[model samples]
Target: MGISKISEFDCIIFCVYAVEYRTVSGVAGPLVILEKVKGPKYQEIVNIRLGDGSTRRGQVLEVDGEKAVVQVFEGTSGIDNKYTTVQFTGEVLKTPVSIDMLGRIFNGSGKPIDNGPPILPEAYLDISGSSINPSERTYPEEMIQTGISTIDVMNSIARGQKIPLFSAAGLPHNEIAAQICRQAGLVKRLEKTTNLLEGGEEDNFAIVFAAMGVNMETAQFFKRDFEENGSMERVTLFLNLANDPTIERIITPRIALTTAEYLAYECGKHVLVILTDMSSYADALREVSAAREEVPGRRGYPGYMYTDLATIYERAGRIEGRKGSITQIPILTMPNDDITHPTPDLTGYITEGQIYIDRQLQNRQIYPPINVLPSLSRLMKSAIGEGMTRRDHADVSNQLYANYAIGKDVQAMKAVVGEEALSSEDLLYLEFLDKFERKFVAQGAYDTRNIFQSLDLAWTLLRIFPRELLHRIPAKTLDQFYSREAASH
Candidate 1:
């Protein structure tokens, strides 16, 4: 009989013939230490069988000659070191991939928890996918409209760019993320009107959303939001609840990225991977490091936290000869609103740019309170202007930044000298600051705007200043878009 058709007895005999080590030396929280292990590879999957004939899954975190440290995914609370057996699977952890993954809800370990049918594997891909060669990388230039004025106008997201939303606790970052997932796409009107510029094809667009260590309420909110907006069809969601095993948090993003890679590279889809509350993921890493008795770096995180984060962030990009691309918008809440905290600090160095959400704005009742000045998209310049968004996009953006800077300076002066002491020009700038925050940066949570509408609104605001003060915009652009009647204000 073929090996595949072997009886249960034969299978047991084959398992008995395979190498098994009963050398579990110690259990530390979620980790298991194995001594006298021979040639155990790092990241190798291990099966731990207990005395009750139940098996748990684990991964080899470290292998030093004959000693190996394994992190159990299901925790090690009930395992007895004397009777447990560890068997190395001779393979790294992998996730099954298929096009049907869209609209499916998965747990942290990539297992479907929605009571849906099992995933029919088209292929199995290593969760730790190989990095794209730098030589094979294509520069990201296409603009992705999130329909939020602050993001669309100022910190524009681009295809294949790793842009993170740096937020703090109690901010509306979740609402903003949900809005983007609902409204993000290439503007079809722009494509139809300006055929010369590159635009995202609707059919090729997809989203992979991974929420790590969120509470049950937060998870349900995201699901309801997606389902209500009818965006679940294009989204592959991975929810790692706060109550789930902390060890599983480390694997959540990898699973999400693996599915994104399958969709983008193999299935030729433009995928946006949204990872939220990365602080929780980082905390999980710190916990695992502590469990392993490893020395901690800044803020008790692992010494290799930066390198480990790079493994996840660097997965987003465009490869040469591939029609699809992966763009990442990772969201992490700054601890105590401290951006200098290790989590946000390390992420800032790895990502292309960041979108900062302000607490002050949220407190002011602004729905999507994106703080414009501190936020930026480094790839925005190449992705906007001429045929891409609009001919006046770059000029308008620059003028808005310049005017907003001046307005902020004037506001500071007003606060120091009192508003009564301010000149008419300073007062005008003060008004501009207020209007900019209220009208430009803030919008209703569900309201969506295209590039044209956002730019038009920008022009309307800029016209509040005298035409002579608008030096950033070219004369021709002024003639084309400027409204002289509104400039009288």
Candidate 2:
């Protein structure tokens, strides 16, 4: 049978070949090169039986006539080249998905790890998700309130948007990711502006959190935090440990996205997928590329790294006729705080916008530590307005950006020249910088603020300066929201 024809049939039925070959020629890293194999299709799952009775699972990476190369998911250690037997399943990797997956935990390869029973799957979907047609996409508009002031008020994440978090090594990105999982939801209505926190509705919202190459401590933190806060029931967690096989890391995100797509399209749930430390995923890709002896791109990463990332990020969006949508927040740590690193640099191109975590702000003990100047949400404007968030959102966001930019510049100048050299107005901006950082950007990790609370807090901070100083605000908006209470006090 032709391998291509076999693959087509494999998609319909479980194709398990009874023939087992002992023609394994060599083992290198995670790859097992088999010679004299017959018609093994690319990406077909295989069973590698060791000299012992145990069997390991693998996927065909390459096939040339009668020769095939397979990547073992459990890694290639202690396999006798002559005695090892390979069986081609003639099918690609697939995972069982169900709505019951909520609150369950799975490993990188979609195997249960939480001692839960097997999912009664409605369907088994290929982990390599199909690309969304561009013509079928609906623009992301509804806002997803994250409850963090910096993100909610400044870089707002829209539903169906793919926004990334750019962090440095040793930062609190995991904590932030967990916090978002706890507090994220869509606003039901702005019924009353007095207490904006009351408008959140998460009954239809679910989080698919996949942590790749994370340590035991970090994984436990995520699990414990979700459990203690009672948000685990609506979350589907996928964990890949630091010691997991490198090949598994490459598959972890695809499996997670497949589950997300199932939840969004099949079950009609608004799904938010958070992928932590994507740098680890890229590193795994580089390792696999090296084993395949492929040519490297920038910084030794695979040339197809960009294409690979696009497959992940592009899966998140609103389909034109679908009832539910998929939003993504991919967190990647830049090596040595370098924003220009291949990981963050290419991510910037694919994602809607990024929330940059500043090392300097973190050093100063600012929670979330967002460097607002560099952080942006390109879809923020479309999501927040008269009916969506608030009429004052655009003006307030712009004013905050303008004033903060000026305050940062003044603070930098003060550092270069002595503070005594500053003019009176300059010193006022310095004080604004301090208050803005402490009150606006910095908050307790568990402290959750809704969109109205965030905007009200912004107005409170803006009142520190005269109206003329807040030139970004329009005359009508200033007359309505601006209060002179701070100046009176």
Best by TM-score: 2
lDDT of 2 at 174: 91
Clashes of each: 0, 0
Cα lDDT computed for each candidate against the true fold: 0.89, 0.90
Model 1 per-residue lDDT tens digits across residues 1-489? 655665766634333455789998999888999999878999999999998999989999998999999999878878887789999989999999999999999999999988999999999999999878899999987788888999988888888999999998889889889999998886433543644323234577999999999999999999999999899999999999998989999999999999999999999998999999899999999999999888989878999999999999999999999988899999999999999999999999999999999988888898787888999899998788766788888899999999899998988887888989988888777888888888888788888887777887899888888878899999998987797663333
Please give, for residues 1-489, the per-residue lDDT of candidate 2 as tens digits.
665545544556578647899998888888888989878999999998998778899999999999998999988887877778888888899999999999998998888899989889999999998888989999998899899999998998888999999998889999999999999999754554533445457978999999999999999999999999999999999999999898889899999999999999988889999998799999998998998899999999999999999999999999988888999999999998999999999999999999999999999999989999999999998788776788899899998888888898998898899898999889878888899999999999989998888888899898888888888899888887886652232
User: Each candidate's TM vs. the true structure?
Assistant: 0.93, 0.94
Model 1's C-alpha root-mean-square deviation from the true structure amounts to 5.1
The global Cα lDDT (0 to 1) of model 1 is 0.89
For candidate 2, what is the lDDT? 0.90
Show where candidate 1 strays beyond 4 Å.
Answer: 1-16, 188-201, 484-489
